[model samples]
Structures are given as C-alpha cells and as structure tokens.
Target chain A: GAGVSQTPSNKVTEKGKYVELRCDPISGHTALYWYRQSLGQGPEFLIYFQGTGAADDSGLPNDRFFAVRPEGSVSTLKIQRTERGDSAVYLCASSYTSTGELFFGEGSRLTVL
Target chain B: AQSVTQLDSHVSVSEGTPVLLRCNYSSSYSPSLFWYVQHPNKGLQLLLKYTSAATLVKGINGFEAEFKKSETSFHLTKPSAHMSDAAEYFCVVSLPSGTYKYIFGTGTRLKVLA
Candidate 1:
C-alpha cells in the first residue's frame, strides 16, 4: 500500500509472552517513529530511527521494549515478557525528514491477558 | 523540555455552529506545532501546521488555527461544524533543534450534534 503498513493488526497474548510488531514505512522516508497509545490517552513516543540508526530511544518503557530499523525501510518493535499493562495500540509513522510532517499507520493493537 | 497540553477533553457543538479546540505548548524556543485529527479506526491525519512562516494556518476540511506566541497557544477553529467533523483531535509539538521527535497532547474528542 502507499501509506505506512503495519502487520498483526490485532494480537492477543498472555502475560510473560513475547511479541513483535512490524512496520513498513513509505518508500524514501528516512525518519520513522514508534508510539504507544493506551485507551483514553495520547500516543507516547517510543523510539525514532533516522536511516538505519536509532536516533533516540528515550521513551521506551524499559529494557523489555525495543525497536530496530535495520534497513531504514522496515522496522520492528519487540516486547519481551509482556505484561497486562502493555496492552495498547502501537502506532508507526514516517516522515520524509526529521522535521517534516508525519504519515501514520493504522496501528497494531496488542492485548496482553 | 517541550510538552503539549490540550485544554478540552470533550467538546460538543451543534451542526452549523462554530467549533473551537484549544491547545497550549511549553517550549524555550520557537517550535513546530501541528494539529492532527483521527477518525474511528483510522490513522492520524494532519489538519494544519505552524512552522513560523505564518501565524494563521489554514487546513483541510474547513479547519484553521492561529499561533499565538505570547499566549503560547495554537487553537483549532472552524466557522461551521459539520457532522463529519466529529473526531478526536491531537496537538503535536516538535522542537526545531535536538531529537525532533513529535510530542503529542492528550486528544480532544469533538462531538457534533444535529
């Protein structure tokens, strides 16, 4: 698709399980971002990748949450030992440049039971 | 540290009436501000942005916002509200320097009534 694409639109997993969410950004976009949105709250920044390097990962909740953009095109967010509180919509966005307006994906909904 | 604050959590307006959604930001220097709208089960869409070129920014769907530096605000407005305008609105801010990560405000749910 032309817009950002996210896989596993919806995932249900038990606590302590591992999960990975994938995001395919628009072609040629160099800046990609990951955000987590909980119910009744705003999307929280998770990580940002510029090209193949992670420019910032300050917002990751803990060591259990990690993301990687190996080729600067597709990125994946990994969660280890997921907890019930980890349930939220994981949103992926990309921009032509770091300061440009972002184009977002429909988001991957993760439910931890 | 930069942050965005959306004043209203919920707003209800009748059809054809004016609509207002307030947003405020805290930044040491000039920042890039934006307003985005999200429909049910849809991705966030940009309504407009303020990049220091003009204070009054016009956006799609008859939406517009004005940047007030002294007041530190960027409020979204529309002359006449339509049923289609009902959605969740988010205010975002990105610093010109540094990480350039967008900071989003808690969304405001707009309800357009008949």
Candidate 2:
C-alpha cells in the first residue's frame, strides 16, 4: 500500500462487547504505532511495535486493550470489554525507522454505545 | 518524561492575516519536535519538524516552526492565513530514548475568518 491502511473505517458496538481494529502498514516499514483520539483532543499513544514485537505498550490504559503484529506487516488492536469511554478514533501509523517521520492512516472511528 | 503543551486552545485570524500558534515542550534530553495538522474528516498530516539541526523548519501548506531550546518552545507560524488553513493543529515531542514514543499536546484550533 502507498500508505498505512486501517480496516472498518467506522465501527459501532455495544458497551461490554469485544471489538477488533486492524492496521496494515506501509510496505517494509519496521515500526508501527497505535493511538486514540477523543473528540476535540489530540492523539494519545497506545502501543508501538518494533518489527513483530511490541516494544512499548505502556500507554494501553488497561489490560483489556491488547495489540499484536504477528508477521510485522499487519497488526490488530483488540479490546476485550469495550466501554463507552472507549469511543474514539483509532489511528495507525508506520515509519521506515523508529525515529523517522510517521505516515498515518485514515483511522477507525470506534463508537461504543 | 516528555510532554507538549499548546498555549492556545483556539485562535482566530482573518484571511490573508498572519497566523501564529504557540507550543511548548518539556523533555529531559535533546528532543525532536513536530507540528501536525488535522482538517475536518482527514487524516493527520505532518506540518513540520525540528530535529536539532535547524532552529527554523519549513513544512507543507506554507507552515513553519522555530525550535527554541531556551524557551522550550516550537511555535508554528504562517505569514498569511487562508480559509483552507482553518483546522486543528497539534504540537508533538519525541525523545531519542530507546522507546521512540511521541508525546502530543492537547491541540489548538485555528479559525480563519474571511
């Protein structure tokens, strides 16, 4: 893909339901990142992947949130039990190097009702 | 620890007037700063970045930012505002530490009046 690609541009789910958001990074990119942006707020870091391993997941808020990049190309963000507060736009970005400029996706707007 | 602060939550400017959006940051080491813009219904776009090599950094859409280490600031400025420039801007800070996580500011909404 010419840019990072995210699946299900919009997702509406009931509270307490499980949901999965996918991200497909640019070709050959070594780093991927996930962020959440609430309405009218800046993006908040969620997790970062260096290759296939999650190098940083400190920003995952709680244990219910998990993300994985098995083959280092596509990644999935899973929320075990969604809450109303989880409603936000989930953004995915990829970079050739960890310190390089990031290319963002259109993002998946999650609405937990 | 690293963090970014956007001084103004909202700024209004008439078209063709100068535009200024203030930002400040705190970092323990030499930091990399960036400015990102978000237009309605669009993905976030990189406006500019300061990587310690230059104090002034130019970006797309005629936007620019200056890195001021002393003041811990990286403020975005445009000589002239355009109606298309009305959008939300965010200031970001990244430390070179092994993690490479970026800290983003709250964001500033720029309103360009015709």
Candidate 3:
C-alpha cells in the first residue's frame, strides 16, 4: 500500500496469552510510533522509534508491553501475559521526519477474552 | 511536563449550525499543537496545526483553530456543521520539537444531527 499498513486487523485471544501486532510504515519514514486506544478514549502514546532506536518509551504502561523496530521500517508490538485490560486498538503512525506530519494506519484491534 | 485537555467529552450540534470544540494545553515553552479527526474505524487525520506561527490556523474540511498564548487554549471551530462531520476529535501537544512524543487529550466526540 501507499500508506502505513498493519497486520491482523482483528485478533481475539484468551487472557494470559501473549500477542504480537505488526506494523509496516511508509517507505523511507524515519519516525514511527505506537499507541493504544480504548473505548471512548483518545490514543495513548506507547513508544517511538527513530531509525531503529527507541528514542522515548515513557508512555509504555509497564514491562508487559514492548515494541521493536529492528530495521526501522517494520515494527512489532509485543504484549506478555495479556490481561483483559490489554484489549484495545493498537495504532501505528509514521513520518518522514521527527517533526513532520504523521500518517497513521487503520490500526490492529486486539480483544483479550 | 506538558499536557492537553479537551473541555467537552461530547458535543452535539444541529446540521448547518456552528460548531465548536474546546482544547487547552500546558507547556513550559511554546509547544506545537494539533487537532486531529478520527472517523469510525479510521485512522486520525490532521485538521490543523499551530507551530508558533499564525495564531488562527485554517485546516482541511473548513475547520480552524486559534492558538492563544495568554489563555493557553487552542479551540477548533467550524461555521457550518455537516452530518458527515460526526466523528471523534483529538487535541495533541508536542513540545520543543524534533521528537515524536505527543501528549493527547481525552478526545471529544462530535455528534451532528440533521
């Protein structure tokens, strides 16, 4: 696609199981971000990567949530021992520069049962 | 520390009527502000942005916002509300610059009635 792409549009898993969500950003984008959005709430910043390096991860809720962008193009959000509260839409966005406009993907909706 | 606050959790307006969504921010320095709209099951799209330039910033879809330094406010407004305008709006604040960190408000759900 011409824009950011996310895999597994919807995923449902049992509680305590681990899940991994993938995101493919636009070509040549150096900045990528991850956010989690619950019902009736705005997206909360989780992590940000600047060319394969996590510049800031202050928004990550806890150690249970982690994200990696090895090549700086595709990033994956990993959640361990997923709890019911982990259910939400995981959004990914990218930009050519750190301060440029952002382009977001449709987001991967994860449901922890 | 910096943060953005959305005044209304939800705003309802009649078709063709004027619409307003209030947003406020707290920053130690002059921060960059933005308003983004998210339709049902869609990604957020930027409506407008204020980067210490013009106070009144015009954006797509006939939406605009004013950046007030003294009041520390950035409110989104539209002259006429359309039914299709019903969506969730988010106010974001990015401090300093050269970073992807953004503080997002709780968001405001706009309901346009016909």
Candidate 4:
C-alpha cells in the first residue's frame, strides 16, 4: 500500500469477546510497530517487529495482548477477554529502518462494552 | 532506557499568537527525537525530527523544534498559532530496545482560541 493501512477503523465488542485488528504496512518496510493510545494520552508502545519476527514484545502490557507479523508485510493484533479499559485507539506504524520517520495508519478505535 | 516528558498536559493560545510546547527527554545514548501531531480523527503526522545533526529542525505546518542537548529538551514552537493547529502533540525519544521502539511523553493538548 501507499501508506500504512489498518482494518476496521472502529471496533465494538463485548467484554469477553476476542478481537483481531489488522495492519498492512508500507511496501518493503522492514520495521513495524504497534501502539495504544488512551484518551488524552500519547501512544504507548505495545510491540515492535523487525521483519517477520518480533524483536521486542516487552511492551505488550500482559499476555492478553498479542501481535503477529506473519510475513513481514502485514500484522495483526489480537486481544483476548477484552475489558472496558481496553477501549482506545490502536495504532500501527512502519519504518524503513529502526531510526527513521514512521508512517502511521489512521488507527483502529476498539471499544469494549 | 529512554523517556520523554511533555511539560504541559494542555495549552491554550489565542489564534494568530505565538505558540510553545515544551518537551524534555532522558536517554543513555545520542537519541533521536521527534514530534508528532494528531488531529481529532487522524493518524499521527510527523512534524519534524532531530538526529545528531542540526540543533534546530523545521517541520510542516510552520512548526519547528530545537534540540538542546544541555537542557535535554526539544521544544516545539510556532511564530503564529492557527485554529487548525489545535490538536494533541507528542514528544518521542527513540530507545535502544533493539528495534524502532519509542518512549513517548504523555502528550500536550493544544487549544487555539479564536
């Protein structure tokens, strides 16, 4: 794609429901990142991927949040047993390297009821 | 480890007036700093970035920031504030966490009053 693209710009789900958010990164980009933004806050790092493997997952918060970049081009963020606190904007970004500007998606606003 | 601190949680400025948003950072290495802006329903857009090169960096929308190593600050400024400039701004410092990982500040919400 021309830029980072995310699916289901808005998602509404039950507290216990599992949800999957998808991201398609910019073509040929080698790094992908996931972030979560709460109301009135900046984006928090959730994970980082270098190619198809996750280089750092320390920011995932808890096991309930998991992300996968299967082919190094697209990624998915999966949440299990969602909670109301999980309502926030999930952002995806891609970069050509680890030290350049990042291209961001419009973001997926996940609302858990 | 690296971290960024946005001095103000919110800032209000009259339209066409000068604007300033303060940011400070901590890092173990010569870090890369960046400023990102987010409108109501849009993605984050990079305003500018400061690597180890220039001390002053200019960005889109007539915004600029100066990287002060001694002060550990990268403050965003504009000569004139526009109503369209009202948005949330974030300061980010790249961490040596093995990838393109970043430590973001809490963010400053800019409000331009007409």
Candidate 5:
C-alpha cells in the first residue's frame, strides 16, 4: 500500500517568490494535515482538512501561508512572498479521520534564499 | 490547550542498554499521547499511542510508553537499544475527542552507539 507522498522532494527559491508544495494522501483518508518542521524542532501544525473543507487553519503562521484540499485526497500548500524564515521542511500527513492515527509523508524541503 | 515537553534534547546509549526518553504533557482533559520516530531521509513513523484503552501501551519495535495521570507523563522506554534506533523522536499530545488538535514537542535525537 502506498503511504502519503509529496512532490518536489527539495525546492530552492529566492525570497519574495511564490512556492507550492503538493501532497497525496492515502486513499480513503478523510483527514489531511500540513505541518512545518524547522531544524531541531518538532513539526508545527499548519492546516487541517476534512473532506474538502478545512476543519482548522489556526496553525497557519500568517497571511503568507494557505492550503487547500479540493477533492479530499490531495492537498497543496501555497506560500506568498516567501521569506527566508519560511525555509524549512514542509510535512504532510493523513489519517482515517481527525482523531485517528496519522501517517506522514517524506517532507518537502523548501529552501528560501 | 494541549502541549508536550521532551525533557532531553538528545540522549545517547550503547546497544543492548536500556533506553528511556522522557516526555511530559499538559492538557485540560485526558489526552491522546503518541511517540513517533523519524530516521534520516524518512518520514515520521508511529512508534505507539496511548488512548484511554490501557495505561501501558505497547508499540512497534519493542517500544512502550506508560501513561501516568498523576505525574502527567508518558515516557517512552525500550529494554534494548539497537543501532537502528538512532533517530529523532517526537512526543505529541492531542485532545481525546473533538477535532484532535495536536501539539508537538521539541524533538529528542537519539544516538545509539555500539
């Protein structure tokens, strides 16, 4: 069985540029989550989606971050006017439901120069 | 609000020795505690979880965590350390119900030496 997966394992971009990271969740997972992990830190929640609807986005850092899950299986995290502070590994995880055990994907490492 | 604290940022142990990674949590209610491990170049893997089921929850790879309500701790322990056990471990906490909003602690990097 395929676990959650992300595209563009590594992305390097200049500051002020826009970037998009994609995540493909496990089939039948109704809950998708996005988190960010800075070096030497644990993953911090960003946004959570439940079947095409965002159940929570409070963890999003600010207006510069946004995420969407249109069909409920795949999601994209978009960043506007990227800053060097945003340079970190963006992780995606999915679960059967909001309270179920989560399965994580190999994070997409974004390097903002 | 729910939060987890990993007391040690790094722990080193030799193979065949006991391994203990301390973690403490704070939550308004009974919390769902979990221990996850991540090897270099790999995603996080669920080592074990402690719901309301049992106080001593056993997880994969001979790892276990005992949920202590009195002490507000759910520390992970393993009898024998293996070289492969060298990885970053995270202690996470969430509410028992509702949205299951998670709060992760700063990771503890394990070094298993031979």
Candidate 6:
C-alpha cells in the first residue's frame, strides 16, 4: 500500500513570499493532519481535517496559515507573507478515522530566507 | 492542558545492551500515549501506542513501552539495542483518551555505540 506523500521535498523562498505545501494521503483515509517541526524541536500540530472539513484548526499559529482538503484525499497548507520564523519542515499525516493511528509523509522542508 | 515530557534529552548505549527512554505526561483525562521514531532526514514513524487497553505494548522492530498510571509515565524499553535504533524518539499524549489533538514531548536522541 502507498503511504502519505508530500510535494517539493525542499523549498527556499524570500521572507515576504508565499508558499503552498501539498500532501496526498493514503487511499480511504478520512482524517488528515498538518504539523510543523522546527529544527531541534518536535513536530507541532497545525490543523486537522475530517473528510472535506477541518476538524481542528486551533493549532494554526495565525490567520496567515490556512489549509484545505476539498476532496478529502489531497490537502494543501498555504502560508501568506511568510516570515523567517515560519521556516520549518511541514509534515502531513492521515488516519483511517479521527482516532485511528496516523501515517505520516516524509515532509516538505520550507526555508524562509 | 495535555502535555508530554521526555526526561532525557539524549541517551547512549552499546549495541546488544538494554535500551530505555523515559517519558512522563500530564492530562486532565485519561490519555493515549504514543512513541514515535524519526530517522535522519525522514518523517516520524509510530513505534507503539498505549490506549489503556494494555499496560505493556509491543511495537515494530522489537520495541515496546509500558504505561504506569501511578508514576504518570510511559517508558519505552528494549532488551537489545541495535545501531538502527539510533534516532530521535518522541513521546506524545492525547487527551480525553481518544482525541485527535496531540501534545508532543521534547524528544530523546538515542545513540548506539558499537
């Protein structure tokens, strides 16, 4: 079975630019999640989607961060006016259900210079 | 108010020796505890989970963790340390027993000496 997959393994952009990270969850997974990991730190929760709707967005740091999973199979994490502080490895995970065990992607490393 | 704490920042053990990674947690409700491992330049992988169903849980690669409610701990242990086990390990907690939200610990870096 194919596991979760992310796009653009590495990205480098200016501080004021915009970036969108994409994730493709495993087939039949109904719950998707986004997380960010800073260097030398554990992954921090960003948002979660149950089906096509977001189940939890409280972990999003600010309004500049947004995510969507319209069809429930693929998701994208959008960042506006990216700051140097936003540089980190963005991770995506999916589960069969909200409470099911998570399967993770390799991650998209974003660098805001 | 759910949180997980990994007592050690780093641990080192000789190959074929015992391995132990300590973790403590705080939560308002009964929590779901998990251990995840991350190799260099790779994403996190689930090592095992404890959902109160079993105090001792076995996971892939001969890894296991024991949940102790009295000490608020879920420490991971293995009888023999392998070089492949050298990686960053994270302890995570979910509140209300079965929730999607997770609170991750600081993590422990395990090094295997041959």
- The lDDT leader among the candidates is 1
The true-versus-predicted C-alpha distance at residue B51 of model 6, in Å, is 0.8
Cα error of candidate 6 at position A54, Å: 1.0
lDDT of 5 by residue, B1-114 (tens): 678899999999999999999999988888889999999989999999888889999999999999999999999999999999999999999875435577789989999998
Regions of candidate 1 where Cα sits further than 4 Å from its true position: B97-99
- Among the numbered candidates, top DockQ falls to 6
Candidate 6 docking category? high
RMSD of each: 1.2, 1.3, 1.1, 1.6, 1.0, 0.8
lDDT value, residue B65 of candidate 4 = 97
Steric overlap count per candidate: 0, 0, 0, 0, 0, 0
Please provide, for model 4 over B51-106, each residue's C-alpha lDDT reduced to its tens digit, 9 standing for 90 to 100.
77889999999999999989989999999999999999999888653337777899
User: Which one wins on TM-score?
Assistant: 6
Scored by TM against the true chain B, the candidates give 0.96, 0.95, 0.97, 0.95, 0.95, 0.97
The TM-scores, one per candidate, come to 0.97, 0.96, 0.96, 0.94, 0.98, 0.98
By DockQ, the better pick of 1 and 3 is: 3
- Pairs in clash, predicted candidate 4: none
lDDT of 3 by residue, A1-113 (tens): 58899988999999999999999999999999999999888889899899999999988999999999998899999999999999999999999999998899999999999
lDDT accuracy of residue B52 in candidate 1: 88
Q: Model 2, range A46-72, lDDT digits (tens) per residue?
A: 999999999999999999999999999
List the candidate 5 regions with Cα displacement exceeding 4 Å. B96-98
lDDT of 3 by residue, B1-114 (tens): 888999999999999999999999998988999999999988889898888888999999999999999999999999999999999999999887435678789999999998
Residue range B4-98, candidate 6, lDDT tens digits: 89999999999999999999998778999999999988878999999989799999999999999989999999999999999999999988788
Q: What lDDT score is found at residue A83 in candidate 2?
A: 99
Candidate 5 pairs with clashing backbones: none
Using DockQ as the yardstick, the better of models 1 and 6 is: 6
- Interface Cα root-mean-square deviation for all models: 1.7, 1.8, 1.2, 2.0, 1.4, 0.8
- Docking model 3 quality class: medium
Off by over 4 Å in 2: B97-99
Alpha-carbon error at B92 in model 5, in Å?
0.6
